[model samples]
Target: GGDNLKAAIFSAGFKEGCILLPLLGARAEVAFGPAGLGDLYVTSTSPFGRNRTMGEKLGTGKNLEE
Candidate 1:
């Protein structure tokens, strides 16, 4: 993915700087997007994040779509 981004930049001759940040305190789908750069990350806000207040939901067998 990093390589892909670099390629997109190099191939396009992009020289300007841009900022990219995961929207904080927002749903991941909304935070990222149709152009989302990275694979799903486990952040503090994610339901499965480390220190998950309710524990990693996946380990508990919760459906991902729920």
Candidate 2:
């Protein structure tokens, strides 16, 4: 899935450097579970959004009580 996304980005003419952070962010989610998702939220282009906030809280051991 990530590989396909990467290929698409490259096909779109984006250089490796431009997409490295995003790929790494995606890898975090695939490799680290919720904690990785949190990291992805912070590291990806979109930061401090609702999903990111939730991921961060969950990564910090917060339960989804609500």
Candidate 3:
């Protein structure tokens, strides 16, 4: 999903850049809500991002609270 979106952004002439997830999350929270922009962050970093990985692990039955 991010790949496709990245390709679109690239084709549209936006240079690729990496903004740390927490910072992005913070800005999004300010704009969106206290719950944070979880979907936007996850989808933006999907497939290999730490947040995405954590979400995947949790989704697959791994427990973070041990």
Candidate 4:
């Protein structure tokens, strides 16, 4: 679907951006943080982010690590 494709593009953009934005924040934090992202949190760039949708999957018994 066109809409799904567009949504995936946006999602990837956000996750990729998260990979960048926090790295440029500082040196030490970047070295020690998750994916070198530090404690800086990247919120969903859209309401349709997978993390947001995970709530439903969790309701179905999916673990956070899944």
lDDT of each: 0.41, 0.53, 0.52, 0.55
Which regions of candidate 1 deviate over 4 angstroms? 14-66
Better of 3 and 4 by TM-score: 4
How high a TM-score does candidate 1 get?
0.19
Candidate that beats the other on lDDT, 2 or 4, i.e. the better one: 4
- Each candidate: RMSD: 11.5, 11.6, 9.7, 9.3
Model 3 regions lying over 4 Å from their true place: 1-29, 32-45
Query: For residues 1-65, what per-residue lDDT tens digits would candidate 1 score against the true structure?
Result: 48787566543432111122322344445434432322223332256544453356766887565
lDDT value for model 4: 0.55
Score residue 65 of candidate 3 by CA lDDT: 77
**How much is the lDDT of residue 20 in candidate 4?**
70
Predicted model with the maximum lDDT: 4
**Evaluation by TM-score, superior candidate among 1 and 2:** 2
Flag clash pairs in model 1.
Answer: none
Candidate 3 all-Cα RMSD: 9.7
TM-scores of all candidate predictions against the true structure: 0.19, 0.30, 0.33, 0.36
Which 10 consecutive residues of model 1 have the lowest summed lDDT?
14-23
lDDT of 4 by residue, 1-66 (tens): 587886677667646655675577744444345533222222233455555577667889999888
Worst lDDT 10-window in candidate 4: 36-45
Backbone clashes per model, in order? 0, 0, 0, 0
Of 3 and 4, the candidate ranking higher by lDDT? 4
| lDDT by residue for model 2 (1-66), tens | 597875575444334433564566654224334444344434443566667667778999998984
Return the candidate ranking by lDDT, descending: 4, 2, 3, 1
Evaluate residue 61 in candidate 1 and report its C-alpha lDDT on the 0 to 100 scale: 82
Give me the candidate number with maximum TM-score. Answer: 4
